[model samples]
Target: MKHIIERAQIYQALKAGIKKTGVVLPGDVKRALHQAIEKETGPAGKVLRFIAENLESAERENMPMCQDTGMVVAFVEMGDKVEIKDAFIDDIIHDAIADAYEEGYFRKSVVEDPLNGRKNTGNNLPAVIHHELKKGSDLKISLMLKGFGSENCSRLAMFKPTAGRDEVIESIAKIVVEAGGSPCPPTILGIGIGGTMDYAAKLSKKALIRELDDSHPDPYYAQLEDDILKRVNELGIGGGGLGGDITTLAVKVEKFPTHIAGLPVAVTVNCWADRKTIVELKGKDN
Candidate 1:
């Protein structure tokens, strides 16, 4: 089998994934949209009707589901037996972002420097990459195109170990309520618990990749997911914040055992346009 880590191959995978997934709206989003449509009681429903039509049209056309193509986040899992032909992992991901944005005609939403000399990188290169090595030969790549609208709404809190479940639940609920209409409600909620502030936040963001319809395996946490989902809809932040139930399609929490004195929680919200895809590469013969 030809060892392939050429930038072009990476580009092809990124673009294909973007086209196929076309911004994944979770189950809670569908529920929220329907609730808002039912309760809107005015032309606001018409606005939502239009939004729905637009999403469908954009998908059918293979165009970007949203103009803000978002920040490219690549999750790379390296197989044990594969050999890269001629590229660094970072370079592959960055070039893929650049290629997809340019050739795919998606917006470049990245800034070179956040503080000084702000400049557009033009093609959205230098993706934010998280890498892990695994025990196989074929490489795997997963992606999430994170837009600032939702990303800006991420929150982290460090609580006393005694913070308890209620406190954690409230923090997430408040974030959704305050975020109202922004981040394009109804949204997916990713909760990271038990780590330090930063690790908690990372876990929350990555958890968005979980399929929207699946429940957590742990029953206790699975119940927490359902409880959070139910309460979030009660916030009345319905689809696009037009007012109704269905504020969330899913609530996912990933946790790690932490020090006895701390309870850290982080929430990352993904708008209705929750775009992600994963690809597992196979050799020519396979």
Candidate 2:
């Protein structure tokens, strides 16, 4: 017996998911913003109030929350027992992205070429896709619309194994300071430790999707998150980078095993919007 899924169904789901993500702030992020507004004063508080209002309006109107619709980053977990009928997985994703950007009026920000004759792709095609294989007959997809304001502020550092935890903390603090008002403060920090350079970077991006209300299961990392969040807020970046406490809403860390000689740390910055949505499809054996 085979558990099968249709390509059209997958495409429609992807299309809807991307569109929704662009317009809606995740519950965790929205709640954090409301809390920040209550805790803030002066201009920072005003900014948070405006941001909250914007988010509400965007969802109500079914419109993009931001001018920069951002590049789509997707993480797909596929089950070995189920197959996508009559289409390649990635092609399906690209098609869905293109249609979503067009029909949803999302800004097409991707470039066809990295250098020289750089031209707009016209549609947000060729999403950055990450795939993983998992047990059971289920397809889980998560999408992130990552705007350049935060992406540009992200940093990666490769440290010697002896650099120690203090060094790691210092590095993260340095990033927040340097980023200043640029990444649109009251941002979330996604810190990825260990692993190779690229893997570390990927982990950092993946960390952004973690729920803001949750802490690292490991007590060590959970403590680190608290410490880092405190240090970052001390920067006085505040909401919209106008200056105050609450530069960072949360700090999330994800780590992978790496070689004995290296400790690679990557930080992915996400603006207060933190747009993301996830979809899951289950298949039953016939």
Candidate 3:
């Protein structure tokens, strides 16, 4: 039986996602921040305290956690057995974003053109959407609001297949070191390895949505993540780059198959806000 989803459900989901993610830091993120605060000292500790206070205020006041509401990126998983009733998914999502941004008074950061004109899109329409068809009868939507401050600091590199693990580690660590506090320290690092250039980049962005508390299922990758995280924190960049122990809140890595001769890696940095929201919808009982 085909599961039918209503247009209203999609609209509500998009709007709620924006509101939820924009204002409140995720539970895991908050916990990490608190842990950082306890472990930090000196100016970095003070800076972290201020960040925590600001986040609490934002959540209490129901205001955006950051002034730059960011570019919308939606990942949608649609079940093959489901059909929407009288609604186009993309259209509905964009319209909901327009309404939510307007109603919630969120910043419209998307530009109509990237290079030349640089005109603002005004309503933050045309979200970058990624869709996948799955086997079930439910739909899952994950939204990420990416601020350019961190996005601009992202890096991608293509290594020869024969490059050793040390090469990969040093390469990515160098990116974090050079970035300093620019991408906003206490940032979450998303590392993507073993895909084509573009896919590596995509995987890096996708990795950002994963919770900080979750560990990679594979022990090798888990150890790699831990090693990289330790190296980054040891850089002594500290909170907000003033210098200290907690430069990165967490490091998440995702990998994919690549050409035998090419190993591509991408690093995406996400600031302390790390806004991610998810919604799942199921068909009504027949």
Candidate 4:
């Protein structure tokens, strides 16, 4: 039996999710920040504490955590047995974002054009959407609000198949070190390994939405994450890049099989704000 989803349902879910994400930091992220405070000292520790206080104030006042409300990236998983009745998914998403940004008083950061015109889109439309079809009667929307500070620090490297784990680690660490305080220290790193160049980049962005406490299902990758996290922190970038023991809060990696001759790695840097949320909508059938 096909289960139908109403346009209004999706719009409400997306709008509420966006508003909530903008104001509230995820539990895992809040915990991570608190934990870092215990491990770091000096100016870095002070900065992390200040950040924690800021989060509390934002939630208390119902204001955005960061001024850069960010460009929206939505990953939609639609079950084969589910169907939308009244409107296109993209249209609903755009409407939801427009309403959410305006209603929530989140900053409108998106522009209409990249180079020539550079006109403000005003409502933060045209979110980057990725869709997947699965075999259930529900839709899952995972949204990430990516700010330009960390987004600008993103890097991709196409390495030779001969590149070993150390080489990959060095490359990623170098990128972060070079980034210094620019991407905002104590950031979370979402790493994509293998696959083609573009797919790797997408995977990196997807990895950012994972909870900081979540471990990779694969043991090998989980160890890799630990190793990378250790190496990054050792670089001494610290909180707010003032220099300390905790440069990054966590490292999450996602891997896909790739061509025999190439190993593509992409790193998506997310600042401490790391705004993301997932909304699941079930159709009217069990």
lDDT for each of the candidates? 0.75, 0.89, 0.89, 0.93
lDDT of 2 by residue, 202-260 (tens): 99989988999998999999999999898888878888889887889999999999999
Q: Which stretches of candidate 2 lie over 4 Å from their true place?
A: none
Candidate 1: segments with Cα more than 4 A from true spot: 1-11, 22-48, 283-286
Candidate 3: tens digits of C-alpha lDDT, residues 1-286: 8888898988898798888888989999999999999998757998899999999899899888889898988889999888898788999889988988888889999988889999998998779898889998899988888988888889999999999888998998899888888987888999999878988988898888898999999999999999999998888988889999999999999999999999999999888889988889997644
The clash number for model 2 is 0
Show pairs that collide, candidate 2. none
Each candidate's clash count = 2, 0, 1, 0
Model 1 — TM-score against the truth?
A: 0.87
Query: What is candidate 4's local distance difference test score?
Result: 0.93
CA-only RMSD, every prediction: 3.2, 1.2, 1.1, 1.1
TM-score ranking from best candidate downward: 4, 3, 2, 1
lDDT of 1 by residue, 1-286 (tens): 4444455666577676764555444344455555656665543466567667777787667677777788877778887666666567677667666666776788888888999988988877668788888876678888888888988888888899878888878878898988988887667888998878778887887888877767799999999999998888788767678776566767888988888888888899887777778877753332
The 10 consecutive residues of candidate 3 with the worst lDDT sum are: 277-286
The whole-model C-alpha lDDT of candidate 3 against the native structure comes to 0.89
